[model samples]
Target: MATRARPSACSHTDRVFLYADSLIHSGGVPKLCPGHGAMPPPEGQNMINESALLESQSLRNSVLERTDVLDRVKALSLLPDGMHVTTAMVATYFGVGLEAIKSLVKDHRTELEANGYQLLAGEELRSFKNLSGLQSHTRSLAIFSRRAVLNVAMLLRDSEVARQVRMYLLDMEYLARTQPVDNPVHRETVSLDDRIDQRITHILGKTVVPMFNALIETSGEHRKELIALRAGVQRIERRLHQHHTRLQRLEGVRDDRPTVGVMAAMDAMNGRRFEHHIAKLLHRDGCTDVVVQGGRGDRGVDIIGLTAAGQRLVVQCKRFAPYLNITSPEVQKFVGAAKVLHNADVALYVATCPFTPEALSIAAETGITVVHRGLLEEWSAGEPLEVLE
Candidate 1:
């Protein structure tokens, strides 16, 4: 990733050889480097493979931000899917215990899923196992892409392989910062127009959306029209997103798709959209018969789903401001409907906001899994809750 001034003593051929050697030995995916067509292992190939980075959150952030390096850490043996690896393979590649890998996934499920981690279940699980030639009796399987594996490298602490990858990333970063750029003409990723578009989207999200909500709430006669108007804005926003995705794909790196994940997309969602989003996440996590039930006369239940193990699940979704907190009274209503009326085997109260201490206590005593902002984050990131089992 570093472009340096060629030293007079180092011939172009020697530079080519040296750079190629670095990439190969560092286990980076082979790529044709520019000019001499030699590739240097993208800085931090191993960083994605290991989960430990000397206890520095900044380092992890750095690795994630520079996903251009995902393909550099080559030598990944993928299954029949050609795009994903099982949890077992990841453990073998990192030379750590399977539980260790699972632990990292549990701790940083949000980040990993943002990159490409997934859990396969039901028909998906059966198909994957059949295609990959795996014979396992497990009801679900965890999988990761090269991108997700690289994320794990940044979080894992005990692997020597991971350490080497981190060291490689550091060297390249130092060289990049210190070396002079040959091109004097400035290059930019986002243009002025693009920034303006993003700003407009933010205004629509933070301002216009709440206004529509208020209008719909107060105006009994015009409520339906206001809702339709809001839906049109949402469609426009999604179309703009499609255009943005096209622009991103047209960029230099083919593997480097735009970094937008479901979490960021959820920020633009209104109450109804948020309910559907949670329902989709539950389905992705292997829930069967998942349904969104948010509406008048829904009796406090916003979602209904079945866990992979056949347990009945009922969920209540609250799409409040992130800074707000759910009160015990709010949670108590969900408990009565979910536990007493529906006889839910597992009840989850999911909110975009945090829960009050008393609210959390009530959830605990009532056996309701409180999926506050943090827990919902991980669940959205692809990690199923323990109760889902």
Candidate 2:
């Protein structure tokens, strides 16, 4: 399939392109340009003196060496022909959650499909369905081609796995250009330094390079580690916020009557006792066919029922201490299992404790109603169950 050209690594300007071309041959030595940060010389500057040329050759060698090491990283494919990787494979390689990968694909369906995302169909899909025993299902499997993977890596801004994949793709592109050719005549005519310089020029102008503007020169692997570290810090901050919210909820509403009563009621109920209470509450809310799915394989939804309006409703009850907040992933999973898997028209996520901001956001997006203590009190007092529009 024909794919659109990736964005240029450098800025999208004629001057940047021209300067990027000469940067490899001019040796992008550490220089204090007036406006540009660690960029090449201006358009009309003659900075490629004899000494600079030698340094450019050395820099070219170093880039090639680093690319060679990247070539040995087994996660990268080595086939001369372009290698296609599936979305599942990419997720596994990066140690990212599969649901997150699927979410990215869903959000960028058009762009990703244009860049070589394939939905298994016709003979291939039929064979897969037969093998996987999904013969009854109509949905086709979505797979990402090599370029499509790179495209997604560029767009998955929140994932550290995608960052590493970006680094890998850049390194592989560099290696492909720098690899020695088999043509003896061409090899002899073009010196290794010239070939390396041309490859560098191509990378600077054509490829979408990750911006690393530090003073210290870093290897691709080292740069990937740094990105992963930065992502880790962000994750830590998110976790801390969740924890802080949990702490505040657990201790913040001590003086409030309704919240305190809810906490006391939750503390008194064990697993089986909690299910019994949930069933009673759901029954009292005019739900027929009320079922307590409190077993080991309850599919994450603890309660199932039908409203008076004959709408299918699913509920996930959490009988936890107030310090524990239900997370976004849990909400996402519950929403998926309820609405998608169980054919629920709407869902109620009941928890004694308050929800995290991320969880509330997910609930809002997925149309799942979060029933906190305050809402539960209203429901128990004969108020009809109402979801926010």
Candidate 3:
């Protein structure tokens, strides 16, 4: 019979706060700004009562039982400080309309803002616009921290989508409380490293577990000799650790709008997937017409579209490994194709990786705008691109 593994030294208290970390700051959860949005119909605090709280909490537990809930909400990312999700992300996760979410915020503006709904303004707003590649005329953005989302979910009773999201929140919180992840040290919370470790464990179970099991049973008298096998396992662990560390570093370095969402997407995608990602990003950035010509022979351009301003834009995409740098010859060809052959008003050379100094110099001199990881992050995250002449 297989032995039941002993539980690690992780605390239940740690697990309980996994979702609570959204609010309940060290000092205390603060109240929302007054007059931020229209009042809650003068219903007073009676609309959401203690029974609603209990029901929501019960529902939270119910949602937690399903294991794939987190995976379904794909926007969950560990920002530099903590796990973060946005209002748009919440809507997407619940399969609700964005305008519905906006309406919810409009109704419960004070309560949500108290819970950490951020209204971007001034330079921060401008920076966000630039990073997201948003044209000058796009609507202003409203971002909510994870806690704010939970508050809105709890009170949102009208929309079918909101009802689903409320259940999702309850289930997530309950799961975090009842089923803490079993790590080596028994961490109650899930972080990027924990997720990476889970992947490593899965890989090892598929490839190394059987080998180790057989070795343990067969090597009886020769068990001491098996010490050498430890080296191989250690190597595998080291490689996994290196990959995880690299990903965390990349995520940590960026403190921009839509930070990890764009970076993670770029790093994880390639070839046709990368092409589609670019197209989707363009659409999100308000491009009226965007097309991807995959497996093509017409011209050097991989993406052709019209910018929101009706400018004819030709985009050539280079999906490459991080180690590979784009060179000047590649730039020169695209420049000619975009400007001369296609008769485009703007030419964009986009690469998943970095560009060689010579390529950068050539692009600058020829007025061929190069979009590398940084610019790609900006554009993909919804910043408007300023097409160089």
Candidate 4:
């Protein structure tokens, strides 16, 4: 007897073709200057944002380009494929609760399935897990194509960032439909210097960063130096990214943009300053009488406060480089401090970087809120931490 074939990373190009056919039949997409075409309005937009889906920026699957466009709404991190994103990643991008994303998925499952939403399990799931190095123990995982994510943005009503994304899509669509201005400047041409900068940035992000990761893992004698060098390259990339953002700015960086928010301020601070920053963030969210320990005789907790609803809150701050991972031991120590020593109702282990898979597992098992780099960016940008609510 013949067995069924396992699923692989199937292309969404068929959906794109079908959507294009629908638009053609309904006169939905606006025809543009020769080769150009207008994107549909936010309400009935089909498929995904083509601006983001363009594979021109892929450095042989090493670096994903068009990040500036995606980050306009929020910084959206992608997996190695650069085409797929997890449900949690979608939640992070929208600055909403994970449950909220699940709610959207539940309500729009049919439409999303038509646009490349997938629930992976069994042999296919195991294959993807090995390739991506994902750490979840769940029997299945939910993943979205870029088209499905854009579909979510259309239906999502809770986030200001999502609202901005919808508006941006609408505006771009209308702009493409309008007549071209003879006096208007176009960005189609790449300047020599700008092209050079793009090359350097691409190399640093795709080639050099991974090289440093490998070196740091194997080079025990100079791991710190390797990390430091990696940090310096990351800083350069960030500065270049800022420059690119200025070039990409439409009506200037919007007030809701996170790049101008707490992340920048916190990045400039030292350990003591980070403690105060966390305290102030708590105070901003209506925590009363928040106290910062300033690294003196503080066993593990760096900040303590009471929530607006009169619940005890304890936080431990770790301001590490984004490339570095917070280990399980550090989170374990915080758990002991927050629960055993302080008897806190809310325990937050906040860090500037990501946590190891083991660290995240510990946080989940112990009910600690792990505010890694992505969530910290959201929290710093005035998006209330879901745990706080």
lDDT for 313 (candidate 1): 90
For each candidate, how many residue pairs have backbone atoms clashing (under 3 Å)?
Answer: 19, 0, 13, 0
Assess each prediction's global lDDT (C-alpha) against the native.
0.65, 0.54, 0.56, 0.65
TM-score of 2: 0.33
- Reference-based TM-score of each model: 0.38, 0.33, 0.38, 0.39
Q: Report the CA-based lDDT of candidate 3 relative to the real structure.
A: 0.56
User: Candidate 3 has what TM-score?
Assistant: 0.38
Candidate 2, position 78, lDDT:
20
The list of candidate 4 runs beyond 4 A from truth reads: 1-264
User: lDDT at 229 for candidate 1?
Assistant: 71
Relative to the true structure, candidate 1 has a C-alpha RMSD (angstroms) of 24.1
RMSD of each: 24.1, 24.0, 21.1, 16.3
Residues 1-389 of candidate 1: C-alpha lDDT, one tens digit per residue: 55545567853334433454454335343332334322222454332212345466656666553332332222357764344789988887777999999999999898788888999899988866765556789999898976688777777778754543454455334333322223223233345556455555545544554455455444545445566676676556545654554343333222222222333334345789789888887887789999887898787798887999899999998887543689999989988999998999999888876788999999999999998765776787667788876
lDDT of 4 at 322: 50
